[model samples]
Target: MLLKKSPSNPIQAASMGINKTEDQAISGWERLRFLYEQPSMERDLSRRIINMAFLTGFFFGGVATSAQARETFERSNIGQRFLSASDVLKRQADYAIVRFAKSGFPMGFKCALVSGSIVYADFLKIFHCG
Candidate 1:
């Protein structure tokens, strides 16, 4: 029996009664080629502008957050001597223990520990301390 080759099928072409050159040209590789058309110059420029704006906003947002954290730290006056998160984490342990001891069980100790941990986390986020 003769197999009729469809232009879209190569296996049919290989076993076909008549092999057309155009059918042979539609290889598996053609499907792998990029299907999307290139962006127009205006579209490309707008994309670039949008990307830059997003990056700029991201940078400024980080800066603003850090500044706000620094202001909060200054206002709190908890550990004025400690400059960064690493310093706070290292030295605050002693303070935490002392406060825990003075304040004692359940409520006081928990409050001291939780507050200290939260402050350390905030400092780490803003300062990216080692």
Candidate 2:
């Protein structure tokens, strides 16, 4: 008569290569490798990146639109309030005379100040020497 043998554990069976489909608990290193080799994982990462970029672009576009709308509204509202050509000329003449008077001193002072300001301004001007 032959004696009966005891059944081996899953780990011992798999290690002996006699048993297959071992769904038993995997070690830390094996689980990590399995996850690293998994397919469709990169798709999840890429989807998140694309979504973030789209949101950033959308936010900036909204800001730009608001800025443009505000500028348009200001232009429309202020156009009617701007001074007319005749009014502008009268105001400029009035302002120049006031500025000249405020410069103080005499006619000689006026000539010297005017000539100095003009000379420096002309030097700063762009010239097409051609």
Candidate 3:
């Protein structure tokens, strides 16, 4: 039986996702060389533009939400203090915003208010700055 010769190029081996210790032993230096030799993957122009637009939209949306939240909080005449969601709910408040902003997330949260003062903030566990 004649066994076919395996590939000697590191780039070919890595790109194929072949397992290591399989007769073809690729050294670290070879892998780095392969990475340097390979050209970057080309993407379609429209796809790239769409991705950029999506990212920009997401970023601007977050900024807008934060600004809206800050304005709402300030206008309520409540001290610039934020409390936990559960804590806010437990406190005595005449009305609640029901829709508020938490740091670093694109979702809305509920805030309890008492006489225009923020009592507590209930938000998702995704992310929060403070």
Candidate 4:
């Protein structure tokens, strides 16, 4: 024997149009069809492209700045000496001494070295450089 299901609520049954077929229900792709049919689709697409380009440029700009900083640090006098130092000394050394002039005072800077190059430096103290 087969059983026929009946609507539990009269209002819901009327709103749902009991005669409507299952095929009339909206599907996932059909719901998104309105986006493609929109008049401002081209404007939205152009905005998305511009946003992506700006993000890409910002990311690469940061990378380039980091590389430039590393290069500048490596070209300094203290950086040159640090790179030429023996591996054992490089491992033990964590500070660099800097002198601004021939008779100038010396300054010590705490530094982090990586791949035989200075990656970071922070001022530690001013001291005699005799």
Clashes of each: 0, 0, 4, 0
> Once all C-alphas are superposed, what RMSD does model 2 give against the true structure?
30.6
The alpha-carbon root-mean-square deviation between model 3 and the true structure, to one decimal in Å, is 17.8
Alpha carbon lDDT at 84, candidate 3 = 80
Instruction: Estimate the lDDT of model 4.
Output: 0.35
lDDT of each: 0.42, 0.41, 0.41, 0.35
Q: Please give, for residues 42-85, the per-residue lDDT of candidate 4 as tens digits.
A: 33554455455545554544444554444444565343444545
Model 3 C-alpha lDDT per residue in residues 1-130, reported as the tens digit of each score: 9985656764475556654454665554554344446553321332344455545554554565655664565577566455786654444231222232133223211111111121112211112235
lDDT, model 3, position 2? 100
Worst 10 residues of 1 by lDDT: 119-128
Q: Candidate 2 at residue 52, lDDT? A: 52
lDDT of 1 by residue, 27-65 (tens): 332211211123334334444554555455544444445
Candidate 4 clash figure, as a count: 0
Model 1 has how many clashing residue pairs? 0
Pick out the ten consecutive residues of candidate 2 with the lowest summed lDDT.
119-128
Best by TM-score: 1
- Candidate 1 ranges beyond 4 A from true positions: 1-38, 74-85, 89-130
The alpha-carbon lDDT assigned to residue 60 of candidate 2 equals: 49
